[model samples]
Target: MNGYRFDKLKLLVADDNQHMRKLISTIMKAFGTTSVYEAESGEAAWQSLKKIGIDIVIVDWQMAGMTGLDFVRKIRNAPDSPNPFLPVIMLTGYTHIDHVRLARDAGANEFLAKPVTVKALMAKITSVIENPRPFVRTKTYFGPCRRRRNDMSYKGPERRAAPDAIDVDGIRPVGSGKTGSHGP
Candidate 1:
């Protein structure tokens, strides 16, 4: 049963650049993806959505016919919502803060600054799958970490920890005080 859980996932790659679309599609296939649908522009991407189902979307920031942001807006606005809870990763060469903010506002779950490496893309996919919420940067003894949910506010980290519950960095606890207990 556990083996079946990690089956191939269908993905969509949307970019006006033909080479970019091919590159993303190829990378996804290399990552054990089952199928990858591609579109040269947002308009074409929208049409593709109407035809087939996709598990996730990897879109370029700038495109002709319609921008990637607009494509996301359309997906989120569809009557039947092609993928209502679908995860989207926006790729852009530009690193402007405003662009990142715009992508967030436009319903992007992850952002990859351009010249994105295969390792970076894989890491982003892994992180988003493990925690499907906005990424919040936080520092810890381990290293720079990402907090998944907004409500994960640790009140000075004084609470007893769970035995099997690993930290955000997937590190197992070496020692613990107790479990099923409370503190003041």
Candidate 2:
């Protein structure tokens, strides 16, 4: 029987380990990635990317040719390209926060430790795919608004103006015997 979705997604899984590459591709296929691509090295991954419209990239931190850090830097530095908005996830065996921070600073949208579980991996992929953040800001405004995970601020629909209450105008006795208009 078929499982979760496996369509309309072009994912690239880059790793030096053939086994790991297949594992990630299979997992992504199971999770409804229709067009999953695999690369055995950073250079191969970069070459594949040049030829395909990859929606997400799962890269290993350590690679033989251009390291994952270098690959990410390349993507981030290519700000003028049409596909510069690609969401990248760095996969590594390292657990240090500094390592994770460095990956983020180097243009990684998310970081995952090696031997990643299907649940965690799927969650990470889904998060990045569904909520890719903006790399540059065109404009910013501050008001009563909430920011989405993608960093887009949304101001809710405009509120309707309150209806004016009915007014009664009539001559009324004020103070002694003087008459005056009561309402307007």
Instruction: Output the number of the lDDT-best candidate.
Output: 2
Which ten-residue region of model 2 has the weakest summed lDDT?
163-172
- Candidate 2 overall Cα lDDT vs. reference? 0.65
Model 2 lDDT tens row, 136-174: 422331111111223245444422212221111111122
Worst 10 residues of 1 by lDDT: 137-146
Choose the strongest candidate by TM-score: 2
TM-score of every candidate relative to the true structure: 0.69, 0.69
> Alpha carbon lDDT of residue 135, candidate 1?
31
- Pairs that collide in candidate 1 are none
Give the Cα lDDT of each candidate: 0.64, 0.65
**Model 1 misplacement above 4 A:** 1-7, 134-148, 152-184
lDDT of residue 147 for candidate 1: 27
